[model samples]
Target: MSDPSTASIVSTPRAEQPTETVSPVGAPQGDRKEKPRGLLGDAWLDLRRKPLFWISALFILLFLLMAAFPQLFTSGDAVNGSLDRSLGKPSGDAWFGYDFQGRDVYARVIYGARASIVVSVLSVLGTLLVGGAMGVIAGYRGGWVDAVLSRVADVFFGLPFVLGAIVILTTFNGSGTSNSQWKIMGLVTVSLIVLSWPVVMRLMRSSVLSTKEADYIVAARALGAGTGRIVLKHLLPNCLAPLLVYGTIMVGSFIGAEATLSFLGVGLKSPVVSWGIMISESQSFIRVSPSLLFFPSLFLVLAVLSFVMLGEAVREALDPKLR
Candidate 1:
């Protein structure tokens, strides 16, 4: 009915309206887009999805709870022992059985968690604080300071861990007063800190050196940020991820080191329940009551493995190269 030109114009399809793709829920696709998460956030998201992370985290939490309040785990006395109950099998009250000294092996094992966990945790913290600070300083301000710190680290690194711990602990042992539980723990912690910090220092130093040259750092410098501000605000944050990963793995290593020192008779003394000391005492009874050795060893292995697994999982999550 319309004119030919008018009809042609009407018949021509209008340019397709640029319709936004809608999601199943009828929201625009752009609105459904995910926001970006930074490094730590991304790592956390990844960590949450990993079964290994959850398992390790759960085990570590349980150990921490046990260490902090051992009473929750057991009420039996770890030190008090009855000669009559010596080498007894697992019974009604005693889940792991009596040890060579007739102490409730379960109680001793539970209580022992305190010393080992405390020592490893404290030593690692000390290492991180002292080593991390020194490393940051040296890495940020290279040249003579770095040289001196590097040399000092090398000197400490050259000293064998076990041998150094033995010598240091022997000196403390000679002091006689070091026989106390806290004193023994202190000596062991100090010895470990002295030996262990170099590795953390080197790691942190390397991380810092690499990070200080990043575009953000240069931008901060261009913006007239002071050295202290740049290091504290920017560089340190970047350095922490790798350092934390190392610290986690080192926690397990430190635990093993403490056990080794205790086994060598220079770690925790009598009256201070520890897995290593338990292992040392139970070695002779292995032929008679293998449970004594088996139970504590099992716990130690579990603790170490948990931390190691956690470290590995975190490393995988944080490292883009791994992804």
Candidate 2:
């Protein structure tokens, strides 16, 4: 027995060595840190791990912010009607200078982003919905349905989109008011949807055709799954990856088409600021006021290039072969 004066010095159980904590060696790290499981999750993981993805994301976000807040970055009115200081060069006050109408180049470019993004996004959606539906039907049915749809797509693809848009706009030319801009945008969007869906349709049809022949599809069919049920439950889900990749690439193309049509005076009528309008305006003052040409063109190029780069990154990220 210890002496009465000597108190017991029992050591506390070493703080119980936290079971929740993880060591770098091989121990569990906070409940196994559940890994993300879906396509979006995988894409996010890939994006975070990739330098190109982050760089592309950053640039795109910067442009989007600029587009959203033109007033924050520039002076001189974007939509000022009167030509008070037309063709002004870059100054401390006016960052990107003024255009032929004294409207701020920076402001117009920023505003143009709205039009570009809207058109691109809508066109992509339209293409996916129309084309994807048609492709799925045609590929799965593969009878007269496929024949009729294929012929229809071929006919539209053969017709020149730019020329068709020009003709449409020429026939429906408005007084170039605010209302006219909306009408022009609608027409352009329709024209693009008509012509653009074929490529996506082709892609979707091919993808569905291949997917429908897979072992899983056969197994589903043998399990008494009807055509509608099989397609809804299985085929469509498998086709999502390719559709997404194609849709991403098509956004850039649609933007380019919109810009082209606007430049030709067949899209985005007056009162609607756009890159096409900027280029069209610059045609007159190309010799004297090159800023009109340079800044808008630069933004357009940047927009297109950024989307293209982003599409490439997305494709790589989604590609199982790459993984």
Candidate 3:
């Protein structure tokens, strides 16, 4: 008995018809506007506009490529050497010249990137896993837990980086030889992690403490979200900016630290072929072949500065106040 006009309007609720209704409120069907980007997306937009970021990014990419594929750049073997050519200066056949051991300096430098990058990168990653987790737990569940963890972090953090590494690495004195090179490297990496994670833990804990009291977080908790869910879903994203900046800078720091340790004869020993090892070996020959000291040190500085610059750019981009 319905009127014809009314009948047409009420035709049917077919499955296909509901698709249009599912669009966001006030939005037109099949004519969606772009959704607003989140923090990282906004960060990317800001980073793109900064020349420093691009420059540092290019250097990092080249370093990474060198690390991943050293063979692509040179057919020369890093370990192969001739004592007759020892301390030879840079020439057409040997760009970086020869080391005291008579090995091609250029080849060693290229191959050295793997160890230096691996140790520094892995140490920071492990720090993140250990420190970031502990921080989340402390910040989310305060009182006794926070007090204990904070105290522990303070104790380790009290030691200077170089001093602490020397103390911890002292256990492996004269141990990393040809057969056990990788093993010693692994232990060195672990030692670095133990020494360095406290800072990251403190940073994450403070960040979480600042963010947990926000209205949205309180609302999420009030709605019956569990601790893990709240920590992972809300607290982490909001609190990650400082940690990221510090981590980037720390990578460069660790690189220099590793080099220092090697220079002191306590890091990345023989057969490891790192920039640190190269520098360590070259220090003795500086009077005879300054190129030995120069090339590796140049690369080391470049690598460290690249990471530091990248961190600076990231900090400027991520912090709205800084921007």
- The 0-to-1 C-alpha lDDT of every candidate, in the order given, reads 0.91, 0.81, 0.88
Which has the greatest TM-score? 1
lDDT of candidate 1 over 7-33, digit per residue (tens): 988787756646655468755675466
Q: Write the per-residue lDDT of candidate 3 for residues 177-289, one digit (tens) a residue.
A: 54477777787788889988888898899999999999999999999999889988999989988889998998898888888888887887877888888988887888989
Q: Which candidate is the best by lDDT?
A: 1
- After superposition, candidate 3 runs with Cα above 4 Å error: 1-34
- What lDDT does candidate 3 reach at residue 147? 95
- In order of listing, the candidates' clash counts read 0, 0, 0
Q: Cα lDDT for residue 52, model 3?
A: 96
List residue ranges in candidate 2 displaced over 4 A.
1-43, 67-76, 173-179
TM-score of 2: 0.83
Task: Name the lDDT of candidate 2.
Answer: 0.81
Ten-residue region with minimum lDDT total, candidate 2: 3-12
| Winner by lDDT between candidate 2 and candidate 1 | 1
